[model samples]
Target: MHYRRFGKTNLWLSVFSLGTMRCLAGESNAEENIQHAIANGINHLETARSYGKSEPYLGNILKKLPLPREQLTITTKLPPTPDSQVMDQWIDESLERLQLDYLDCLAIHGINTWEHLTWVESPRGCMQAIQDALAEGRIRHLGFSTHAPLEVILAAIQTNLFEFINLHYYYVFQRHAPAVALANQKDMGVFIISPADKGGRLYTPPAKLVELCYPFSPLELNYRFLLSDRRITTLSVGPANPQELDAPLAVADQDGSLTPQEIEVFSRLETQAETALGTDRCSQCYQCLPCPEMINIPEVLRLRNLAVAYDMTDYGTYRYGMFENAGHWFAGVKGNRCTSCGDCLPRCPEQLDIPGLLADTHQRLNGSPRRRLWG
Candidate 1:
């Protein structure tokens, strides 16, 4: 597998790191996948307290293996439970679940707002817990994961408290490019999540997108596009199974990559997709705030974008199922939760008609019959 310098850490990390979201679902088969990944040179394993049962399953698998903990890098996150005591409890629980004495890296999960930053960075905040864990040798490094506005990310980086960062970045979602660049400048490790959602759709893309990315598989084009930037320390790939893992590993070995001409074509394709969708690309800034129903507007917009951009109605359907069946659904806003207050309109830099676009998105994905304020 291709390896890149992990910023100033001087560690060479595989471009294809294993993500544990799906692995948690297959607890019965997680060992096999973990073994497969290790055998294939995937030295980095990423999980989180928020991903159900992932840490516990991984802990069980590691306990049975003979591999030394030092040979592997383990990354996980603490959920924003808000209470510092709860954060401490979560960290200890994570360590117990992972069967490790200390975490190589631990992040404050999902910092999407300034409020989140304040809570984590305050004296009585989660950062205190993180610092205590570091002092006690329970965590080697502290960091954070975010899908916030670029300014928020920039502000976090300025604190210089983190050793690493996880963020959403890819060819299609270039919002975090500036943050990635800043991480590079600071010698901090940068991890990217969900290239497929950010970059590829399982189904065929529009002909124009395909034409724009000639000589590269949609996956390869997207991966290569991100790898072109040196700031990216690692790219996390969520493979449903072992077979799906091969493509990304192969991408690491490519020699002659997409040329400038291909890049130009890809750019045109992105523009065309935006034009055709007719919705302002959500930068996931969450500037449109206080959804009456607490629906995560950016996440919904992302799912909608995936549905249209990748043409994977089934995938979109599954994502929609998460909203319908999951208990923690829409901690931010429910689907169709907008009251059409239009308060977020003036705040949006893109000037998108939030309510109108959401209505169209709801109709396109869930059909008109299911339409309502909180459906």
Candidate 2:
């Protein structure tokens, strides 16, 4: 396994960290799965208080495993609270559940809005309790995970209060690229959340994506894309069983550079997208903003682009259905909510039919409702 310095935290973390959201779900082989991952060099285990049964499951598994405590890094997350006392209780609860004396990392989970940010940065809010924990050696590092808009993410990074950041910056959804760049500037560790699953659901990729990726599977291609940017520290891989770790482990030694084949695949993807969408293609620039209906026009349209260009209808539908269901984590109304007020029309340099395209997006990608993993 290849390890990278996780920004200012100064810890060498494996490029693929084990995300335990899907662990202990039903008839799970938790011990074998975790042990296999650890044996193959995935030294970081990430869980959350909200990932039902995950913390306690890890606690039991850790006790039974023969590994030393210091050999692995364990991290957990809790949402921000209004009161520092409540935050204190949460910390104690997570520790007790995990049966750990202290945590290698504690991330303020789901800072997905301005309000969530306020909850963390307030004078008597979670940060105070986190600081106390840090001073008392309960938490070795402080970080935050967010699904907020780019502005909110940039604001959080600008605070300089965090040693690391966990956010979404996938090969398909590069909207958070600026946030990643800023995190690198601040020397903050950048951990990508759910690249294979949330990042276009590459685990079950479409035919076009599979074809574009050529020799590499869509999952492997995405991993290579993220790891090529040295600023990214690690990616969360949620494997259900021992063998599920093999795909990511195969690409572990891929250094911080893209192969010539990778570059060709990237070019192929872009050219195909442009060719498929023609002049109506969304360039992903954020000029069209301040929608009257609070619709995330760019993201909504980008989903359409993916579906239209790459035949990624299933992936598009899965993500689109999570709009209202995900609350602040996704942070936008669906494309069906566009009122055709023409507010975003003039702002769009592409001069695209904003309302018509949104209608088409809603038409093409509408499906059963979906929710985020933590939602």
Candidate 3:
């Protein structure tokens, strides 16, 4: 594994940092995975209080081991709720859950809008709570994670309040590239979350994406693509299993940059993919599982992305066909049946706008004259 300094913090962090989302589900031996990662020299372990028992699970594992707290960097997040009292309680809860006296880094989870940032900066706001935590020695540093548009990220950075910022980035979703560069210029630590979705999805892309990525794993190519830019300080992996961890670590260990041929391949693949898929971010992970509407979420999104990326409707008819009875499936609570209740939004490992995306897809696939549905 390779390590790099995390911007102005002057702390060395593993290029491949372990994200705690998958670890929370209790699918694997939490203790073993934590020990194995630390044993393998992964010094950075990121978790969130909202990650469904992740903090508590990690807390249990750590309490059993003799690992030095100083040697490990534990990062967690404060929920983006407007309730200051709730935020404070959650912070204390997170500390207790992680069995730590203080967090190395505590970020404001999911700063999705500029208004949210403004609210955070206001009096008695979340940022103030973070400052209070820092004063009380409960948190060492402050940061935030975002899935908003690049402009929102830029706006947040310009506020000059964050020590670091986590955002989606990879070879395929280069929209955030300029923002990453700007963050580096500002000397802020840049953490790239889920390169597999941001990068890997494009690497092993669908048939159309494969034609775009050419000779790379769409995965390796995406990693190489991100590594080509030195501004990225750490790349967080949501490894469902140990095998998922190995691929990126292997790539990080390699010295030197992408070969000219690889670079050319990336360019060609990117263009081909854009020509084929339209949007650059969807990874088709199929995690929006058991679609309530039988709408084939991943497939429909894939076709939509292709239509937008490639500017061709070659797959539209087939995509619409899949959604033929989507309403029936959704009616009983299956696919595009989101009620805007905001439950699944936070549960999503990808942090996607589940409701909004579903609504848009429903309209596009079932709203036209040829496919109109009576409400």
Candidate 4:
């Protein structure tokens, strides 16, 4: 139940916020679980306009609960639309669905490309429309959620228009940490999304990682790792059912400090990882980037690490399949595209055999060529 200054908002948000992305699942005690989480000091409830039925479901639960309006912090992301009128309609609909007078925060959901940024800046765009809502007292703060490239994300943060940001940054995907630090420097709130599930699916963590993070579940380690950094404001925990809240609730009660023993464990884990994955293992340093094949080298290699080191070959294969479909959001090839011209090898500080790793990664994770997500 510990709270921290949510950047420039100055709101003392609980380190863990209740995310409403998966609340509509058929769980009998879903509402009661939400009430319990609220009772345990989770004041922030975050949702998006496009998260299926989550907004309405949470609205019904909040209406039935005894909590007052002033005691709760509600946030919802307005789906990005090029048409200003449609954006207006979506914002109004979100307000109606949430049954709230004013949103504590409203974000432009999935601002994932430079084109999206351009659309937001266009005359008939959501930015002005949302700001109009802001001036009318419909929303208290303006921000955005993005799954864009690191450079694109940095550009958005540099704009200085957002009061906060919701982005992905976890133990396995620390590449976004520099952008997060920039947000901190700009005095903007940073809400990390889906740390457990998207953060390497730690909820059902591989046995090796579990042993590596001794004394803490992989989930706890991931949660604590993000919280240990002072720059991060809150982590969005999207619980699908009542049972899903147990470990997260326990994590929330923790002090969020990494003890000496934990640090030693992490160090040992890194060493073990080097030993297991060998010299060819990708460190995801991005130094060997700018691949000519439009391939996301680090991404494909990390998938290989999942298979070889973490023993998550099935998950790795699934994620590798996602590359062809991820498109702009995660632009990459499935490692087999490497022509082996020795382009990336000389640039690598670790002298990694990039082409060989790519071949192995493709072989390990490209089984049956699963269809892309949203294809």
Scored by lDDT, the top model is 2
Q: Per-residue lDDT of 175-275 in model 3, one digit per residue for the tens?
A: 67778888898888899887874343432355655555566565776677666666887888776666666667668775357799887886776566655
CA deviation > 4 Å runs, candidate 1: 25-28, 198-200, 203-214, 255-258, 274-358, 367-375
**Candidate 2, run of 10 with poorest lDDT:** 24-33
Error of 4 at 104 (Å): 0.8
Per-residue lDDT of 259 in model 1: 73
Candidates 1 and 3 compared: the better one by TM-score is 1
Badly placed stretches (over 4 Å) of model 3 are: 198-204, 207-215, 271-375
Error of 4 at 124 (Å): 3.6
lDDT of 2 by residue, 232-285 (tens): 999999988877788899999986689888899889999999999998898899
Task: Please rank every candidate by TM-score, starting with the best.
Answer: 2, 4, 1, 3
TM-score of each: 0.78, 0.98, 0.73, 0.92
**Candidate 4 versus the native: TM-score?**
0.92
Q: Write the per-residue lDDT of candidate 4 for residues 195-299, one digit (tens) a residue.
A: 977687777877877887888887888787887888888998878776787887787866557878778877876787688888777878888889998778888
